[model samples]
Target chain A: MARILVTDDSTFIRRRTCTILNRTGHEIIEATNGNHCLEIMQQDKPDLLFLDLVMPGLDGFGVLKTLQDAGNTIPVIVLTADIQDAVRDECMQLGAHTFLNKPPAEAAVLAALTDALAEGERKA
Target chain B: MTSAAHSSSTRQLNVLQKDAITELMNIGVGHAASTLHTLIGHKIELVVPEVSLITLDDYHQLQPYEADELLSTIWMGFRGGFEGNTSLIFPTDSANTLITALTGEMDDSPELDELRAGTLAEVGNILLNGVMGSIANMLNAALSYTVPEYMECSLLNIFRKNHTGNDTIMLARTTFAINELKVEGNILLFFKVASFEQLLISIDRELAI
Candidate 1:
């Protein structure tokens, strides 16, 4: 199982994602917000991160910046309910590896996971 | 009462602000519609009306009828700098029909019902983020959301129990049409007081960036 981190503020959503990812055979790490996600990354680096764009404390952007600034190159996939070009563009500019609109589809999530793993393997 | 004047001023400001929020939501809704069209490979129609701004107290009067708790509640949880609770909810009948159209499945089948929560949550994720994200961007505010959660409940209960207003309230009306069938509901956008200004500043920064 891939060590994966899923960061979101909602208990319901975080649980849902964990269930779905676990069904796909990934070891899951949960964080309620970006701050916690960042702390988790420091202690245990995951193979992938499924990030939500909005939350209390630091947001997805802040989490991403913190990771990049700390020199970690883990693959980050942003899952947002918002579908806007500007938001997408800003996220891309900020160094998010990929973007998936919120409530991500089965196919989309799987594809992102596949690509993230492949990239991680290449780096290793 | 000073509260009246404050509320009235807030209401006027609310009016002016909603236009921008609504227009932004319209853009997001259009994107969602397009995404659904491709996902379902069918022509789905969206009728987005002028959005409204309401207080947490006003939600109960909005919907008196409570649908089946397991079936009616389209439970979605969102997290952001403006993080709190807001759902892109629909009643049971409306939700089931919408899902059937989007997935090309029957509303009553156990299999379809099993999948409906996830599908609706995804749909809600798109709609909520699309509208709310645009508002944040227009204000140039950096925001993010949580993975959405789905649940079923009374409309009033959903509002009364979960909604802790995100500083300011911005809500809108949007209807989804699949050929002849119409799925109707409101899109609620709540942002915190500080985020409201942070948003405007972000917008200005974007202009500079």
Candidate 2:
């Protein structure tokens, strides 16, 4: 089981994701938006991050950039309801371990976490 | 600006427009409910006939409570000669409840929640856009859509900014048999007067031409 941080501006989404991860036997933490996510990230690093792209202030893209700049290599999963493919691809290219569509499949979420964990193993 | 031509063109929910719009949304949302039924493998009971229009003013008067005030919303901006925004909101409780159904699991699992939210967002996207896009296609007018913006908050507060203004809204209520989750809320459709008029014209032209 892994301690995973789930970040999105939506409460429904955060709770929903937390529920999913909890069932998977991983511990979960939640944040509302990108800024809150950063505050939490600075304090406790989770096994993985699930992020939403468009938000009120600092969005997921900005959050990913900040983490990357801070030299944080935690695998990030980008979630979006928008139609910005180019932006999503860039996030993946920029170090997002994987990108999945909004309302991901259970298989996809597990796969993403596994991939992120494996990447962490390689880096370690 | 609410000019004569603009005011005249921006008609309220006359019986026809109201019913037609509502009916179209019914077709759209009915389709969405169908998608949910298939995706989650649950029997969902929904009524498109319940769709209606409300101004931002009436929206506030209908003041709703945020069960888990911490917010989560799926949003998409739509524009063309017409412009609008469609949002699918799942409060915390609703999210958990729906997740339970979609996963076919009785317990609340964190990973399932995440997947559920993502699934809801996709489902919302498919539902909202499915209806809206189909409407646009019927009119043969072009609309550009931005990816959905996922958000959270005191939903009541989200609409406080322009509550006095006239805004078209579509509220969707969905109930799934498996989890017995009752998800009901409004989908706000905001647009400038001109854009709305353009949308009407598109519809009219689609009907006539």
Candidate 3:
């Protein structure tokens, strides 16, 4: 089972995401915001990161940029409520494996998890 | 007050009707909070603390806000399965605070300039669309919406200017806290008597299903 890090400022969204991921038998690590997410990344280095955009004090974009600058190749799947095409394009350009809208559906979450994990294995 | 206004003011919704509408509004507001959370990156807590059907006359009597207090309002007109105009209203100071919080602007000036007004409009657009979209989706109804407009005016003037003879108002009192900043606003939906009936019918149909 892969260890997944779920980061979001929202308790509801975070809990909902974790609940869905838990059913898949993946180990889940929770981070309240971006800084917390980065700290956890350095300490734990989870298998996959479920990132949220628009977090206070260092956001998803900042995390992606930091990781890129440091040459970290951790797979990230961005979950956001912002439906703007521009936002999606930016995340994709920043190396997000996929972009999923918030209030995430169970099927989509599982599908993304499977695909991202597979891609990571392929790269390894 | 006109006869229509008087009639609407006296009409009372039964407990079931009131509860159903209130619950639906809560769901809409919850969705709005989720969207707002993504926009500002702050954890947003939104509660439709109260939902009431009243008339412009009743609103005037209740005087929720100071009569002359300046308010930042974003309003839109909607039509289709049901027709009405809805607006999100916040006291000018609260609006400024909210804008500053979202934009991280140092200026706390009371005046809402063109740029700030535009920013507030975008925020309101996200919220109002969230509410309207969720409600419409739940009811499986089609709706056409007008371009949203932003206005800075007194609370009294807001209703006076938009007073469209239809007196029945569905007021959803929304309170949201973004991080440490708490802002309270009212979402007023003005519907004609017939349109209000149509909404209730739609709700009943949903309940039946």
Q: Residue B141 lDDT in model 3?
A: 67
Tell me the deviation in Å of residue A79 in model 1.
5.8
lDDT of 2 by residue, B117-181 (tens): 66566556755665565566556555656656556666565554323455543332222233445
Give the Å error, residue B157, model 2: 14
How high is the CA lDDT of each candidate model? Answer: 0.64, 0.61, 0.73
Off by over 4 Å in 2: A83-87, B1-7, B10-41, B44-82, B87-209
* Per-residue lDDT over B117-204 for candidate 3, one digit per residue giving the tens place of the 0 to 100 score: 7567656766776776677777766665655678977767766654556466655455666646666667666665677788889988
Best-to-worst DockQ order: 1, 2, 3
What lDDT tens digits, residue by residue, belong to model 1 across residues B126-196?
Answer: 66666666555555444545556677766656655544552234444455565556555555444444544
Candidate 1, residues A19-85, lDDT tens digits: the string is: 7788887789899888899889889888889998766688888987787787767888888766656
**Residue A54 of model 3, lDDT score:** 63
Model 3, position A6: C-alpha lDDT score? 99
Pairwise DockQ winner, candidates 2 and 3: 2
Candidate 2 CA-lDDT value: 0.61
Query: What stretches of model 3 exceed 4 Å from their correct place?
Result: A1-124, B1-10, B61-64, B107-112
